[model samples]
Structure formats: C-alpha cells, structure tokens
Target: MLVRMGKNWEISEEISKLQGKIRNLLKETGWSVKDFADKYFWEELDSDGAYGDEDDKSRHAEKVKKHLSSSSSTAKRLELLKKYVEFIETSRLYRKDVMPLRRETASGMQDAGFKAAMRKLSSELNELLLKKS
Candidate 1:
C-alpha cells in the first residue's frame, strides 16, 4: 500500500481513500506511476521538451503534480481512474497492455505524495465500480 503523507483527508476523504486503494492495486499488479496520467495530463506537464518522440509514453512526478493541480473536468479525471482499475483487472488474465502507455518519461521521479493522491482517486473510482458490481 502507498503511504499517504497526511492523516486528515483533503478534497473529499472518501475520494482520496478510494484513489489510494486503486493506486495500491496498480502497484501490486506492477503498474508504474505513469499509468495514472492521461493524455491531458501530458499536455499540461512540462517535460522540458524532453522525449518529444515518446510523448505520452513517459512523464515525471512534477509533471504529474502540474496535471493534477490544474482545473479539469471531472469526467476526464474519472476516466483515467477507471482505466487504472480496469487495467489491473485485465492484467490478471495476462492482458498487460494498456493503450497510450503512461510509463515514466524520465528516471528518478520525485516524491510519492502525489502518487498517493492518484492512488486515492483510483481507489475511489474502483469503489464506485464495485458498488455497481
């Protein structure tokens, strides 16, 4: 499980909790941090024009934060979170492929704090999926 930095929840604890759970699931299933970010996240992220050829294939932690910090439609955010859970579910059956890979754009990404947040979001989405199951 990803260790969240704060005790008190911020921006809806329920969402954070669920996000964390799904994030942990991704890790347990061998998905990297990049897997959480969507293409929109890439457009907002400034990677110093690095890996122009790779594009969405990679991203840094700072870029991830920049993507998360900005205002965006909830639908987009929910879509990414939903993908995370679905990817894990499918991977268990040997379908490890995810369209538009979210691998690390660079080596040595910093700070696990945002990852914790993404995880929380992912978990929250997974919870929603479960409710319907």
Candidate 2:
C-alpha cells in the first residue's frame, strides 16, 4: 500500500503536507535525496525557465542534495519542499509550447493537447506525493 500525502483541498497545505510525508518516505525507503531528486526533479523541470542553463540546474540539484544531507530542521526541509513544488509548477505553467501556429489546425486540438499534458503532470505529481508502505 501507498501512503498518500495530500488532502487535495488546498495547494499550499497539500504541498506542506507532502514535504513531511516525503521526509518519512525517504527514511523508510532507504533512498538518498539524490535518488529522489533524480527520480522526480530533473525530468519535469524546465531548463528554459527558472533553471536557464544545464549548469544552473546542476547547481540547484546539488544544493538540494546538500540541504537534505545536512542536519537541517524539519521546518527548513518543509519550507524547501514548498519552494521546490512552486518551482516545478511555475515552470510548467509558463513553459512555451512548441506548437506550430497553423491556421488549418483542428479547432479543439490545442485544448485537447493542453488537457492531456495537465493530466500527465497531475499523475506525476501524485507519484511524488505518495509513499509506498
């Protein structure tokens, strides 16, 4: 069974709750912070957004690794988690799609595409916010 984190009520609260759940998950699963970041962060993050260059992204990932490795307080970890959630969400929301502007395009294709993308992102977010029990 998986231990789910969010109440699906409010984004802020849900994210906060998720961070704590993630901390426990890390402890229980014997996964390093780097493992978690590699599994959940790099793939979804937009390098063209807040993380402009590959180097910048690498540095940020290192920062997360160090932060988690330290004896940081629980409050600090939760705060960092909220920021990470925000970074991914903001990048995805503002990312410029490469869709070609064609006058002959189908009427609802763009909308359908957007819906599909959102569904995929939501599913990924669920994996991050859930812990295997």
Candidate 3:
C-alpha cells in the first residue's frame, strides 16, 4: 500500500511494524470505525479537494451526519473534523502518513500561526495520552 504512494517498492519488516503501530494507534484513538466517518470527510476535503465543490461538500456533509449523527449537520461537522484532523495530522507525535495529510490540510489554514496552533493542540493531546499511561 505504501508502494502505491511512491517509488519505494521494497517492503521492509520495519515498515510492516510501523504499519501495525499505525493501525493500533488508529484503533486505540477510536479512529478505525465507520462511526468516525465524519473525520475522514473533512480530512478528504482538506487533502484531496474532495469537497471543494458546494454540491460535493453538501453531499459529503450529509453522509457525515448520517454516519455520525452526534456530529450532525454538514457545516458544523466539517468545521469540527477539520479542527480534529488538523491537530492529529500536524503534530510531530503522529506517524509519518499523517505529515503529508497535515501539509495538505495546512494549505487551507494558510496562516502559519493557525497551523502551529493546531499542531500545539495535537502535541498537547499526545502528551495527555502519554501521561495517562
């Protein structure tokens, strides 16, 4: 799967281990299920231009609400998901795949200060989790 992203066709044991770690992190952080689908909606919008069109955004937002009603409504959910994925992807503590996504999302934020602020939130959340253990 990583190979599809780039030219490094070689799959190392270390990379496999890292993949496992990322999967575990996703599960532990409650990011693995469809229940968290709204999270992906905003991230996709930020990273892939998936929701750039108003029609697409509205449809995706409806899907988000259908999947995660607790965070219902397209606009509010997009805002929340953007905030959450931004924090998670930008923080140094998250895995490498997160960085590319973070950089993409930062494009929307535009301001370095806002991006940094989101990163700080991410770092704080990571710290809090570490301390809990």
Candidate 4:
C-alpha cells in the first residue's frame, strides 16, 4: 500500500519565508547576485574542467594530499575551508568588476554614506569568512 501524502502547503510556506529572509538579508548586507554567482564559479569550472590541469590526475592527487594534511580538523572541514577561500577570492574579483559602477553612483549622488555602507559590508563579510577559516 503506497499511500503518498498530498502536496505540503506548510513546506511551500516555509520556503517562501526563507526566500523573503534571503532577499532582506541581501538588501541589508549589500551583497549582490554577481557576488553569489562568482562564489559558485568553481562549481561550473569543475564541471567544465576549464582549467587545463584538470586532466592531470597526478597533480590533482598531490593537491588533494596537501589539503588533507594541512590541518588537524576532519577531512570535511579542511575541504570546506578550501572551498570558502576560493569563494572569497572569486567574490573579490566580482566586486572589483563592479567598482566602477559603485564609484560612479557614489560620485553622481554625492552619497558618501552609501559608499561607506558598501565598504563596511565588504569588510564585515571578509572578516566573518576569515574568522571561519
């Protein structure tokens, strides 16, 4: 007897609430979609093997060994740390790409507050990530 429950409205409501929270957080934190996209760039790169070294199994094994031996934490934590560092670097690159627009907007509106807010947001995010590392 396969008795499947009907669609769960409660789950949908929870997801909607989460989406709203994420939107608000992004707005308050000044985190842009481009930054999030860059954080995920490595996933795309891994799938596409854009890096020529992906084909070199020996090099990959050595790199994996280095990561595994670098810390006393569990292997999962070490891998997470590596990914977090990569994500931060990628986000910095994405932020740089939008620097011109940021400058232009600040200058046009004479909004030092907006610029300062952005600086604070970037510093806070970096600090949080570094502490995690």
> Compared with the true structure, what per-residue lDDT tens digits does model 2 show for residues 16-81?
466665566555445556655653455556533655576866676687766544544355565677
Q: What TM-score would candidate 1 get against the native?
A: 0.34
1 versus 4: better TM-score goes to: 1
Which has the higher lDDT value, candidate number 2 or candidate number 3?
2
Tell me, by lDDT, which candidate is best.
2
Q: Model 2 scores what on Cα lDDT?
A: 0.52
lDDT of residue 90 for candidate 2: 38
lDDT of 1 by residue, 1-133 (tens): 9765552333334445446656666566565556544332443343465444455445444454443344443555545555545545554222333322233332336467776666677668656544543
Q: What is the lDDT of residue 101 in candidate 3?
A: 25
What 10-residue stretch in candidate 1 is worst by lDDT? 92-101
Provide the global lDDT of candidate 4 against the true structure: 0.46
User: Which whole-number lDDT from 0 to 100 does residue 85 have in model 4?
Assistant: 41
lDDT of 4 by residue, 1-133 (tens): 9754544444444444444444454354466534433334435444476653534544554443444334333445444444544454445443354321232234456477888887787778766654553
Give all candidate RMSDs, comma-separated: 19.7, 14.1, 16.7, 13.8
Poorest lDDT segment (10 consecutive residues) of candidate 3 = 5-14
Off by over 4 Å in 3: 1-10, 33-41, 47-133
Cα distance off (Å), candidate 4, residue 42: 3.9
Give the Å shift of residue 80 in candidate 3. 23
For model 2, give the RMSD to the true fold: 14.1
Candidate 3, residue 10: lDDT: 28
